[model samples]
Target: MNKQKQLSEVTELWKTNKKQYVKKSSFSAYTLLIENHVLPTFGKAFHVEETDVQDFVFRKLESGLSHKTIKDILIVLKMILKFGAKNKWFEYTPFDIQFPTEREKHSLEVLTKSDQKKIMNHIQEHFTFRNLGVYICLSAGMRIGEVCALTWEDVDTDRGVISVSRTIQRIYVIENGIRKTELILDTPKTKNSIREIPISKDLLRLLKPFKKIVNPSFFVLTNDARPTEPRTYRSYYKNLMKELHMPDLKFHGLRHSFATRCIESNCDYKTVSVLLGHSNISTTLNLYVHPNMEQKKKAIEQMFKALR
Candidate 1:
């Protein structure tokens, strides 16, 4: 059969499988990979060989995709191949793929106690939308996307809780030389991400005054009545810190500060993990559980004292 025939057959099978099980956003991302990258290279590779997959990966690497993004693309491709195989569309597979020995995301970078205090003081007094975003992130340990996606209705002043259920993303899709913008609102990354974080009672009191000024139907941190963009927040916060003569940190560093404060205050690992909406305890441990010499020395000293 010709390349067009093979592409059509695979595409139809993929369309059916996508409809059956995958989330709309997930399936859309997969379809984008197939259309943009995979089809351009492998459209002619009938029953794609393993070398075809390797060459495609290398070509993408040369095109300057990050290791993580490339890895995710490969995962999507693997899913497509598996779907094709399960439905008996292809007797052979394309992916005998392996990854580079690349480093994962940087370990959580948090602030010291004094830095937290400095930032908090500035945000509380010289407030802007960026400060509001920072305050919510620090106090609630909210992800940046969740913070951006939040509507004012999600805050319960009576209960003093912030509900984190939705995430916002800006996606650009290339279709027939037109780049379309898709502003998507979807559930959080994991089941654990759908949680309520209790805000500090003082902050609840502070927010009560703003309640009178806030638009009930709009997103909380928006400059006007639209959803607040994260890049703008990051830029604004950078300027805010400089104006206040404080050290620079990303908007997410506030979240790291929250988790660190909880861990230092003798909160258990599981409690900290849940409060931070981490899917697993290992994430908590990896961030905050490294033992120090001071802690170890105290432990050994206490052991000897107990024996005496």
Candidate 2:
């Protein structure tokens, strides 16, 4: 019988082969998850038992990792195991891992109407290129990376749209016992994420005069060939919030604020979903749609009326 290979050995082999197919950012994420979590737990094991994995899951949870993050780690582990099984280097067993039911409902952070208006008014008055990204995010619901990647050429004043095609991110790279980070410009997260968002009349007016003067190839945030990374842009946002004296919220809250305002305005779900570039309408509904007491009462009344 051939000797069983340890997970550490198979991981190195799998990574080498997988690197050829995945995007740089994805490969870096897989590598980081493996190095930080999977390898440490299962590195020497030739076979992983379902119970062992369940124990790992519990430990991770106890350590305060989110279920989503722990599941991502498991996905990488499974991929490596499957690769090993295909090559007859290790035994693979399908595992049914379960997580404890979460008691706390996850809530999205969004800016209040007054706060949103205040920030927009401030941006309009201050009007710097960097500040423009924040305004664009509030109006268009673009992700930080997508906004960071935007160049003047992607903005169409004539057409009244912002083309979202690319995103920028900094990812960790590990090679030969060395670790470093690289900034990469990559396609948006999904095909759906690449779409055109119509510019509001107010935003279009703000952008019109500047559009003719700025170099088309320069990024909107920096107004330069080099783009600002998400981390740096986040720091800028933090300072802006402090200066505005607004409640502390994540930069992602701008996106939620846009979606919330759209739903409140009675915009159709499908249109809102498409505008947000969600892969599916369900994602939009799940995140943004929650019936209030008034709506719930109306629904119950309508049901009773139908029964009568």
Best by lDDT: 2
TM-score of 1: 0.78
Displacement of the residue 182 alpha carbon in candidate 2, Å: 0.4
Model 2 scores worst on lDDT over the 10 consecutive residues at: 290-299
Question: What does the lDDT read for residue 246 in candidate 2?
Answer: 94
Task: Tell me which residue pairs clash in candidate 2.
Answer: none
For residues 104-156, write the lDDT of model 2, one tens digit per residue. 98888988889999999999999999999999999999999999999999999
Q: Report the lDDT tens digits of candidate 1 across residue range 1-308.
A: 22233544676577666767855566667677777777777665447778877877788877878776777777766766666666666545555687566666565667777877777777788777657888788788898889988887888887888889998876555556686767778897689999998989757866877776777778888745688666666787788777767666777788888887887678899989998889999988987786545567988999999999
Name model 2 segments beyond 4 Å from true: 292-308
What's the lDDT for all of these models? 0.75, 0.95
Task: Please give the lDDT score at residue 227 for candidate 1.
Answer: 83
